[model samples]
Target: MQAVITFRQFSFRYKNQSEPTLKNIHLEIARGEKIWIAGPSGSGKSTLAHCINGLIPFSYGGEMSGQLLLDGQDASGMTIFERSRRIGTILQNPDAQFVGQTVGEDVAFQLENEAAPYDVMKTAVSSALELVGMQAYEAQGPHELSGGQKQQVALAGVLSTQADILLFDEPLANLDPASGAKAMRLIDEIHRNQGKTVILIEHRVEDVLLEHIDRVVVMNEGEIAAIGTPDELLAAGILPRYGLRQPLYLEALSHAGLPLSGFTDLSHPESLKPTEDGSEPQGPPILSESQLRDRLEAWSTSVLPAGRGSLGEPLLELRGVSFAYEPGMNAVADVTLTVRSGETVALLGSNGAGKSTLSGLITGLHKPGSGEICLRGEVINGWSIRRRGEEIGYVMQHPHHMLTQHMVRDEIRIGLVARGVPEPEREQRTEEALQICGLYPYRNWPVSALSFGQKKRLSIAAILALQPKLMILDEPTAGQDYRHYTEFMEFINRLSGEGMAFLFITHDMHLALEYADRAAVMSEGRVIAEDAVARILADGGITSRANLRETSLARFARAQGLVSPSRFVEAFIAAEKKVKRA
Candidate 1:
């Protein structure tokens, strides 16, 4: 295969930044190959992706060295528009790239720019939308679509241009697990059929590896650490050291003390041939397929049981709440829920499922049409958003939206300073919040220096400084890799232990299963089921109805041929949590 994207001893330093974001990098990708780049939060993976599609030197004013080649040509002189003809970029936030209001207009924007004929542009737009299964939604507004749908429309725009090299930068970041999986499936199909060269920069490692990847490249601190086939890298057991997520199947095997060498392939779990039941068989000490499932089932049942002891008095309550932007159309309707003191409750549902609307009501950002909101038995429906902020801190879904200050410590201190906190105490609380959020080391650094995950922690720290009794976090762990995900959840779990309640509006099932005491599932503006996380996950009917999917561990257990998939799933998840907690 011919090299389509190449970087030779490349390095980049942002304006006024001492350290180069990408240092002495060298990477080459072949035409028609699908490669997944894996890295931790600040390892310069995004910078590398930006460099590939000619954004580093074009959009970002930066000092650079060495050569970058696209399609065997020197890309240093190419304009972003020139690069776009060969390379297409799909960003983490698809909404950022949306230029037109409607899907058809968005897809045809590029064709229109090229001055293509009306008939030619129409055919290209329709064909592109059809490829992503969005043909019927061409005339619909992009804002009217779900997060996943918006992403599909975004891809259609790129596809309409017929760009050969696709650069997807964390495309799954905003999608739910199931939706993420479907998006990956679509990308895989496009790659296979259209033969587009793909370089995907993502932290959803386990999910990305499910496709037929040509190679896997691992980057650490702006340098390529390793590159090889997926099987070689995954089975080699080096990902955990670099803060990258391993396939959950491998994690389960490790947890079970099963020798990983026994497997011929980890990707295709159906092709697995396990060891015998007892004695030293082909892979002894390792359970058979059925035995593996049984072991997982046992662990699942033993994990957190159906019901926790008793929760505290209701801290926040909603009764028959309904809201709408326009008459006769309710965004949130007849919703009733409660969050008790010192308990973490997960609010889960599909995109466009009124989760955000309900949260707006609680924060006093929106007025309830029919129902009342109470905080500690006192009606707070009439409260101002500022008044509610004193009692209930809200961390918006996008960290950048909440982050306003230029410096790290100042960002966290904003809340304290806003409410006239004393200088001495403000400094004291900001330091404590930074330490807890793991941003102490970067206290004096510019807010732009932080990673997406760090920015998220900064958002939390800002809210934590307010000393609110309750907090609402939306997709708190969306962009985090496994290591930070575990650390942040543990931090939140600890905070919840100290009388602070939380309502987590998230799509991460792992976070919900391990951190939340109970889960309230929402669908189409109604709370359908309220139960323990274990119960919610164990019941397939509720999961499917709520448009949620099982964790990879649960899927692994089922794939291993466990007798009872649900029980095994629960047990396996419990065991993993127990191990992590220990």
Candidate 2:
């Protein structure tokens, strides 16, 4: 097969940076092949994608060395418009790409730009929308759609362009597990049926590998660290060594002393078994079913369950609160919940399930139509946004919405200054927050220079400096890598221990499972389930209705026919907590 994209000793340095973002790179992606590029934040994955999609020289001025070729032609001189004719990019944030009011209009924008005939544009738009299962929503405005729906509209826009190569940057970062799985299936269909070259730039490596991938290219710093098939990398145990996490089941196997090299197919847990047809095994089987069961049982029993700490007094409360964007449609309906001091609560649900709206109601951004909101046993439904700000802090799902200051240090200290905090105390809090978020070195840098993940940390740091009684974070870990996510969560854990309350509205199941003490699941603007985090995750019925998927440990237990799979999950979590403490 001929190479559709080539990088020959390519290196690039931004005009504002002292070091090259990409260095001494060499790569070739064949036509019609599907490849995944993964790494931690600031690892040059985005820089490589920008180079391939014609953003490096055209939109972002930079110093470039060596050559990048598109379809056998040098690409250094290609304009973004010229590149768009052959390559289409779907950005991490779909809202940033919308140029039209409705779904149909957005999908037709590219066609209208090319001056295609009315009938031609209509046919192409309809076909693309149907392909993404968004045909029924063609008349809906952008604001009326959910996060996953907006992503589909963005993809429809790209598909209508009929570009030979499609690039997706962090497509799953903002979606729930079910929606992420659906998006992957759609991408796979497009790759197989249309023979388009597919390139995915994502930090969620495990989610990306749920679909088929021809190659996994792992990058670290500014250089390529490893490039091979997914199985090869998993067998070699190279991902964790380079700050990336493998699939959860594989990690569980490792914890159990089962060598990953013995597994031929690591994609599915059930694939670990020998073939039933008695054919030659692809790889050596480490143990029979009985032996595996015995080992799992012994390991699980040896690990004692951890105890939950006592929670402090109620810090915030909501009682039968209801609100509607319009007269007849309630976005938040009859919701009642509580957050206690020194406790961490997870609010989980599918897109359009009113999680963010509930947070807004608590933060005084929206007035409740009914019921009361209370703080420390006093009703606070009449509190002003600023008055509520003194006790509660909110970090929005998108960091750009929360950031106002130009420089990193100013952004962190602005709230404290507005609240009339003393200069010395403000400086101390700001410095402490910057250090906690690993943003100390970038304090003097412009906010625009930071990546999405860095901006997220900055947003959280700003909120942390306020020292509010309660904090509400929406999708806090969306763009972060594993290492930073752990460090940030550990910091949050310490704050909770000191008597601060937290409410997290997130789509990352792993984040909820590992951190939250309690979980409240919502559906159709109503709280449908509330319980301990482990119990909530163990219930398949609740997870299904809430559009959440089971954790890998739960799936692994079921696959191995464990007598009490939920207990197995709880035990694993307990063991993990014990290890973290040690």
- lDDT of prediction 1: 0.83
> Of the candidates shown, which would achieve the greatest lDDT relative to the real structure?
2
10 residues in a row with least lDDT, candidate 2? 274-283
Which residue pairs in candidate 1 have backbone atoms (N, alpha carbon, C) closer than 3 angstroms, thus clashing?
299-571, 300-570, 300-571
lDDT of 2 by residue, 288-324 (tens): 7877778777776766766778899999999999999
- Number of clashes recorded per candidate: 3, 0
TM-scores for every candidate against the unseen true structure: 0.93, 0.97
Sequence-dependent TM-score of model 2: 0.97
Worst 10 residues of 1 by lDDT: 276-285
